[model samples]
Target: MIGRDAELAFLRRVAAEARAGRGGAAVVRREAGIGKSALLEQTARDASGMRVLRVTGLEAEAELPFAALHLLLRPARHLVDGLPWAQQAALRVAFGQGRDEAEDRFLVGLALLTLLSDLAEERPLLCLIDDAQWLDRASAEALGFAARRLGADRIAMILAARDGGNGAEPHLHGVPEVRLAGLARPDCEGLLATVAADLAPEARDRVIEEAEGNPLALIEFAGMLTPKQRAGHLVPLPLHPPQLPVVSRVERSLRDAIRLLPERTQRLLLIAAAEGTGNLDLVLRAAKESGAGLPDLEPAERGHMLRVADGRLRFRHPLVKTAAYREAPLVQRVAVHQAVARALDAEEDADRRAWHLSAAAVGPDEHTGDALAAAGDRARQRGSHASSATAYERAAQLTVSPHRRAARLAAAAEAALGAGQLRRARTAAHRGQRLTDDPPVLARLATVAAMADSELGRAAPAAHTLIDAATGVTASAPGDAAAMLATAADDAWFAGDAWFAGDHAALRRAANLLESLTPRADASLAPVIGTVRLVDGEPAVGLALMRAAVPADDRGAGTIVGTYAVFSALMTGDDDAACALAAARVDRCRERGLIGELPHALQLLTQALGCCSHAERAGSVGIPAHCGPAGRWAMTGVSVGVVRRSTRR
Candidate 1:
């Protein structure tokens, strides 16, 4: 393993903070053969605790196959090993071949996680999944779920991957990265001394210099050297030989793993490596068209055939894939590809449809146009909206018809909007509408653009245009009107100083518009409606109404309970308790990234600050009286205009 004391020190600090009931993340990166795995292993060892679950990357796997996750989190199975048979059976039914299984899996998984957290002796749970680059899409999703669901106090995760040479690895960017560079010269020399003590000083220096202080390289280099700089077992090293390529080592490991698999399995895996997605139906058809036979072997001996529920499956790692794909012959690839095309014709799966369409549409001398469009439609139905958008974008690029391209952009725009991607929605809407003057489409495009600008605090020219569209639309399409109102609110609320600069009539109009659009149900508007009322200079009525609205909910008391406390505490001059309750409320929202509630937090903090100032000695220059200095003193800018932004923007 690569030893870098400094990198380990940083990871330790993060671990320490987590131990002390805080959360932290670390990211690590380096070129191939730079001892990334070595560092990961060391960190994992250091992070050992009562519930340490480890998952490392495999070399060749399908891009996003679901079953690979079964390998990563098999530990979750044992968690149910001791549960009652009925519960276990119910769980099986939940995570198994039925739609309802998803709910059971989640609930049972949550219960198990909670139990584990409570039962663990003293050590915290550390889930380490390494070599994230080759992670299956399902595994990535599981990571997201686990991050939010795992024990808040006892669980932390460690992920490791090689540098993708741009920024950090995309998958690992959400958490922290702990980069693993080359070892220091002293560490390199220390490692060498373990292998061969008292080597010539010149040779040791030469080894360190040649390895660029990379421990693995120095160890491998030292092994291949002689007492002199002459020829040796692996290759004679010069006094100053250049660093050996680690890719070759990675390459050899991959080749060996592939060679060891059964011949039929290897061939199928090799074909899948080239296919990229390795989606079963497509690969199987490719094999059939290529005239490859499925051996009619017995179940016990032919486990590879059913290793995953999906017959045409991916291997576990990208390195395994790179090795096999690099070695496949051209003639074999063409035959398998013919099979793939035939499979696309036969099967009706959505992801496979998109994949096959993508493959055929872009391939040499193939007519990709019509098939690509057909596949794009199927892709959207399969809940692969993002993938469908990609297919449509490619169609836009390859097809010559302006009308067809506009249609493609429209599909892409809808997908973007459904995905909560406002930026992409704005772009696609703008482009698609520009190419088509169809009034309805134009109106839709105008609505999208206006909402996009307004959401980000900019004034838009399309508010009235969208309002016109909403009125023209059918009664069944009230959604359009609702969207337009929300967009207008967003624009007005987020307009900054421009909002305050409106003329008297304009201010009254905007105020009425906001009041009309705000949620009418008292049940929903209790805390926040009262909040705006107080801010609008009617403090007494606002406080009384909010106090009446507070009720005990099973999910914890609603916002009104906390708001009432802050208001009452401020009025009664209980500054310390007021600040404490306000801070706690703010802390809870902050944890949820509830930026919409920040203005409420600010208002409460402002009141608490006022009470504190009133109690302070007159000579003291600290927290001032009134809401002015109080708001600033209590986490300035922490919650400014959050509620106002939602209503006005």
Candidate 2:
């Protein structure tokens, strides 16, 4: 914590504010070995009376959905029972404690928030997440979702993550950040003096200089020195070469330390690292399978590489785990994964076992690929879309058949889209497209790519892609083709007036295609038909269709069709209908714990409120334009100011 007074003060203030019922969160970003974890520990120690919860991300569990969250909330599981039934059920399903798999991902986040708030009702809560960069995508997204909405609750979160390295947590982007740099020269000298008091002054100065103020480097490099080197009788090798980053050097030093341990101990350490969950029993079983035993772990413990407590094993630092796993030969690593997979309960831990099996495989194996694909299905059912994407992608890699590979890639693309990973969805879709010529698979991939493109603001191309996909699917899958046409019309609307003015072809084509579909009086088709009518200059028919689509109750109000109805009402100058529909959407979203939809719902509500002369209330509920889809919609002549002014007249 040396040279971190300012950063400490910021974290302390956040806790203090939360203690006073103003909850907040801060993400601590820094390179490895720069004391991010140390700072988190210090802050936790400083929070005297607060309820503390911690989750340390493990590399082995990075692909397992909700692993980090499961660790963080294990102690607070009892509090979840008091939450609303929807939230409670969501949490149960997410944590694998229930059979119902219809949990919404956002509902899981909401459940976490509620549980944390309940825990903080009696005492302030401090959540410390270390090595957040290694957290699974589902865990990271859920944490971010809850963290962003912390308000008037005695809860504070501080997430420490590595930056400028692999495994960046992009989901945590919107949270407030406290960036850590190297310590100052004076602080580094003082720290070195404490750790290496008897070192020669010249040698100490050289260590301090070479460490570049990185706390781990300072400690580990000094620890590596012999008495002769410390006494200036022998010069230490310059391990911190300019070409290698300090963090890399520190990792190498840790690996070297691990190499000094007994071979059996190293094998035990590798099993522990590969297990990732710190399940002592599982690790021991896996180690025994590799001819290592509990006695071998003593060397690792004495070396300060890892510790065992409460039947669980934990590495001293994330780097220790990384070094242990990476230092092992590939054959040994694969054998460890296979051992761990064997140790897992076949029925209960199928997902983890499948992942390990996939990791252990060196070549195409249809059985393993099928196992991973089933795992992907389970992840998707649990609403862990990112985890589903990873499982499917790995399954695709292990599949020898081109058609199976393409199908898995399509599933991955769709799952990635659900997880809000736009670039990954697009890439997977493109790869799938190149692998398959089947019309159905190609249509699915095209649809996924188009949806991703639309979200990424390539609306014109997205509209064209959707139109083509719909055309390809029309003969075989008329229902899906109609849905695609409807989506194409929505994309054309998202393209805005500028694109509409420049080229009316995409809109005309969408309208023509929808017209060609078998006539149905379904409410789901109202918005698309209304949009087509508007494009064809029949405002009366469009307005009537939009009005018919606006739901009379909450049951239908929380749907995408309802969202389109609100927008259509606004576009057709029906402020009263827009306001009512938008209000209902917001309320339904909150009541159902649909957090992903809430932001856009709130935006629409704010706009509707603004149009109804409740501008002050709108301001209070308003989300920044850039933060929601409303900003893009504003380009289509439905801006707040324009609506407000028109209504005022």
> Could you give candidate 2's per-residue lDDT for residues 1-649 as a string of tens digits?
6799999999999999998999999999988889898889999999988999998887777877788899999889778767777677777778777787744567787678778888999799999998898888788888987788787689999999898533337678789999988889999888987888988887888788778889988998888887878887666555567578888888999999999999999999888888887899999888886688889889888878889999989888778888999999999999999999999975978888998898899999898899999989888877899899999999999999999899999999999999888999999999999998998998899999999999988888998998988888777887777777777777776686574552257777876776677664244666767767777688898778776765554354324456677777777777777777776676565555655665677666766665654444443434333333455245333232222222222
What's the CA RMSD for each of the models?
11.1, 5.7
Tens-place lDDT per residue, model 1, 1-649, is 4367777788777666656655444545666556666666777778745356676554333222332444544666655544433334333433333222221112223333333444333566566666665564334434543444433455666666666531113334466666666677677877888876756776677667667765555655565465555222223344332443555554554555456566666667656765665566656566664454445112212432223354645443344466776655666555554455556564434344444444434342224555555555544443334434555666666666667677777777765554345787779878877787655566566676666655555554434445455444324344444454334433433344665432232222333433454453224334433444554567786576556544332134345445654655555445666676665666554433344455566566655655664544211322243335534545445342232122122
Q: Backbone clashes per model, in order?
A: 31, 0
Instruction: Give the top-scoring candidate (TM-score).
Output: 2
Model 2 compared with the native: what TM-score? 0.86
Model 2 pairs whose backbones collide: none
**Residue 549 in candidate 2 has what lDDT?**
65
lDDT of 2 at 363: 98
